[model samples]
Target: MAGFWLGPRAAMRGYRLFGYDSIGSTSSEAMASARRGDAGDVWFAALQQTEGRGRRGRVWESPSGNLAASLLIVHEGDAASVATLGFVAGIALQEALSGNLPASALRIGVDGADGLTGQGHAARLALKWPNDVIADGGKLAGILLEAQGLPDGRMAIVIGFGVNIVAAPTGLPYPATCLHALGTPVSAEAVFAALADAWVDAFELWAGGRGVADVLARWRRHAAGLGSEVAISHDGQVVRGIFETIDEFGRLIVRDGARGTIAITAGDVHFGATATSGRT
Candidate 1:
């Protein structure tokens, strides 16, 4: 693992950087840092992750060559900003890949099959709502957020990101693609550095008290499922609807049967049969 402790430098800049060579999960490590009263923006980056996970406690493949890191942020922000964690991570990942694949317009895509690659050199990477990054219609990266309160009544939000940089694991539930398969090769350090810079910018923007509508607008431009039939599962009820737009609080607006339109605040959203579906 690599250590890039900017210490007072980052602390003065409002972030404390802590890196590890190997760990069970960067999110877990960042949580540990939070428990020790390491407040503010604490970033834990690892060279290799032994036990990385995503939503629903599913295993997240984190080989040595991929990027695994988590950021612990103690911020005074509303729940809306906190809930839009995926957009922040998605914007960051998009920018990070842009630096490497300058010629290719790196847009987000949904995953269609596990271990599937785009035909020829054209890579179709899509962004799924709430925080799944898909490539060639399969999962490429996932963002998991965990937040807790501090002794001072502040909130510490941990943003964990696992990206498939070098290779995509074979035999997954859905189709998975990697940067290597897309013909873009990058070192782990380079990817992490780019992501860190991008994430810092994204966090600053979100923390500035801007409405989530702007973020939603940006997401829609790169979004893959607008106007598409989808299934939103929340609170043990699965509602099938046409994806209309994103509401003010970042909830997905779905036009369901006779219900007119329903807003989904939290759940696993999957594209309906018209396109393809994947686990949340």
Candidate 2:
């Protein structure tokens, strides 16, 4: 297959693009590049990944024809604030996919979730809290962010994402769906093109984390499972409560019935009656 190419939209944004037919993981490449004193703002896309991983080191199946990409961002900021980029990535991915598929084809309903209603195209694409894109109540895509300190006193964040375009995984913890299965078949290259453009817009709006308030506001508009019962598991403990809202620093606010509003920094969130599924 031909290598992936960035169109004018992505090129105009000053993103250094790299494409591969197969690799261990795009995020791994970005991290290695950062360690070698390379300047950031680079995007790595691969047709297949041999050793991709998800949150908590779960295996990420990246068969040929899926979208496995990662962006290397070198930012000078406190670790707490830089992590908010995950929210920015979620919004960018949503917009990228929504731009390619029709509005009617993107809407997914979550059982027993209020505030799930949306208007127009924005309503169809929903953000599942911190790092997921939900369609038809199933997972369409996921975002994984990893950061490491550089020798030059800077931090490099590798924003990795895997989107099921032509196929979805089977026998997973939760239901998985792909773009083609959802009636919006598209090429991995086309999706990457849109994603690059959207990433530029989202990064600019983030303004070095100064504009996170705006990012969070926009994210809430596409939020899924808001005002619904949910469970979050972290480090072997599970917290179940009402899915409240995202806090100022982008932490998930869960209104535990007994614990009262708990601010969750990292965990796998499960919604509705399936709160015990332990799926992220």
Candidate 3:
């Protein structure tokens, strides 16, 4: 795994990586490194996490076989663009896993849509609003973006992701699944390797949000429940409406019966009939 990142392809792009058998959390470690003025393009991976968490401080269960990884970038772009990187990460992750999964395990939509009609290989994977990946109508992966100002007058953006490669957590608020359960049992190491390369490509495509239109279009192509009824919880209130489209700036656009179009920047989204417990 180290050799893959240290090779010319990754080294030329200034990629550095570290791995741990067990750690508190990959995101926490990356944030600490950034505060110490470490150069960016660093990837941290852990076999297990003792203090892992997801959106809104929800517990993130990282067992022995799942993929817990985070990437730190010293960003100098606008805050809006930096926030959009979460979407970029989501797209990269979906593309990476799709390439590695078997063809038989890939399908366009949860309703059995044909593959060729969607976004090529990415068709099988769906990007649930802000930064969640869905497979087989269940949660497959989650992304969390944490940012803080650096002393050098730049922003440190840590993009953390947890993928269910070997197993998924049980007794969650909503349906959870893993690659193994979906007929594509892969190792955490393999997923991390693919993710690193995919991230580089995705970052280049994002071009510091200059190409956000393209990114948003690609994400919408694989978005789940875009035209279906869904609910979003924010600030202790729940807004139930039709899932419209994501705006140009990466906010969730919902069409409410009384309020017309509403853009939600942060919230816990729930689809039809799904139990709403925490943010996905």
Best by lDDT: 2
Give lDDT for model 2.
0.84
What would you estimate as the lDDT of candidate 1? 0.70
Model 3 lDDT tens row, 140-168: 89999999998878999999999998788
| Among all candidates shown, the one with the greatest TM-score | 2
Candidate 2 lDDT by residue in tens digits, 165-246 = 8888899777677888888878988899889989988988899989999999988878877877888888989888888899
| Per-residue lDDT of candidate 1, residues 115-188 (tens digit) | 11233343355567778776656667778988887788777888898888887889864567677777777766
Among all windows of 10 consecutive residues in model 3, the one with the lowest summed lDDT is 108-117
Residue 83 shift from truth in candidate 3, angstroms:
0.6
Listing every candidate in turn, what is its Cα RMSD in Å to the true structure after a full C-alpha superposition? Answer: 4.9, 2.5, 3.5
What is model 2's C-alpha RMSD? 2.5
Q: Which stretches of candidate 3 lie over 4 Å from their true place?
A: 1-9, 105-123, 275-280
Each prediction's TM-score against the native? 0.82, 0.92, 0.89
- In candidate 2, which residue ranges exceed 4 Å CA deviation? 105-122, 276-280
Worst 10 residues of 2 by lDDT: 112-121
Candidate 1 vs 2: which has more lDDT: 2
